[model samples]
Target: MLRLVLAVLFSGALSLPASADVSIKRLFGKEQRALNAIPQTHLVSLLERSKAAKVSSGGITYSRDWLAGQPKQSGGREWRCLAEALYFEARGESVKGQFAVAEVILNRVSSASYPDTICGVVHQGTGRKYACQFTYTCDGHAEVIAEPRAFERVGKIAKLTMKSAKRPLTKGATHYHTKAVSPYWADKFPRTATIGFHHFYKQPSRLSRN
Candidate 1:
């Protein structure tokens, strides 16, 4: 029976859609005894170690030493877009602020209402007056990437953010504005948190609209 259940679990895991959470959990339930044999704290530690390894391998250790280390080569176009957005938008803000901005950009990408790609989300409404999502993209000033250190720092942040699928800082926020200015849209959304120079918000639910 155990062998048969193990076979079913493996087969179900392989056959089901990767995003099918329910089916995956159902299959996992079949092996609960085996999984439960591992210590919970040990499992959590292993997961943490795996996440740290991914962060380290991407040349972002989430530390000053790593940021001060020799910069890795600039990544591909998607990475370049995200890094540029962060550099221009939040370079002067605290590191946590930069991450928060990056998180909002990424959260927008994942959201149904916004573009699914980073560059698309970052550069949305490029030519329209007072219509761009990110101010730097449409401010009409040449985007001269003059600050090498700042660019390098944000590039690493972007790389790590894309590689790690978790967004811990923003609490599912998809929008933000600097403390210097309050946008009208901010009042409609639920304020999530304030980090550094920026204020974050999550989209309001359908019930909230009514």
Candidate 2:
């Protein structure tokens, strides 16, 4: 089942041209070949376009057919920030790992210890040697967005997650480390799961100050 889910996610993030639309019609259904594919509006449009909906021409007030449980695209600024960070930091990561990375950032966003917003979470401690949440921000080189393709892929994932798509891949992990880093925090948190080049960990909840 894990491999199956991973396969589906990887297929969603598969290589496509920068202008190519990566959408639900491409991933989930086939009828709506050229539907409007905005992350926030696509799903709603998708249901309207597909035959699965029960649109009535017979007239009943002014109501459109609704899907029971369709996934919505995320449009909030926090979702965008999370997407940008994932794109910049983990575009090379596997699909499962990409979501896990986003989870860590979101976890930090909700934690009392870190910033409450995605931009704040990603840009925390700027200018200092190792200040930014994303190392690329503080690294010597400018954060050049050369790969529009990769960024779009990450953006879609962020949109989906922000819309309440559940990713149970990580075990509520707020931290992760690549196989290369051996930080002091590693031993402090319990190891949760390993996906691709990253290791997920959950920290002890011993803090009293809120």
Which candidate number maximizes lDDT? 1
Give the lowest summed-lDDT range of ten residues in model 2.
Answer: 59-68
* Model 1: per-residue Cα lDDT over 59-145, one tens digit each: 444343445564575778899999999999999875667877998999989887888999999999899998898999999899999
TM-score of each: 0.67, 0.61
Residue 136's lDDT in candidate 1: 97
The TM-score between candidate 2 and the true structure equals 0.61
Cα lDDT, all candidates: 0.78, 0.64
Off by over 4 Å in 2: 1-76, 207-210
CA RMSD of each candidate after superposition: 15.1, 15.0
lDDT of 2 by residue, 63-108 (tens): 1222112233446678777877887778877555676788777777
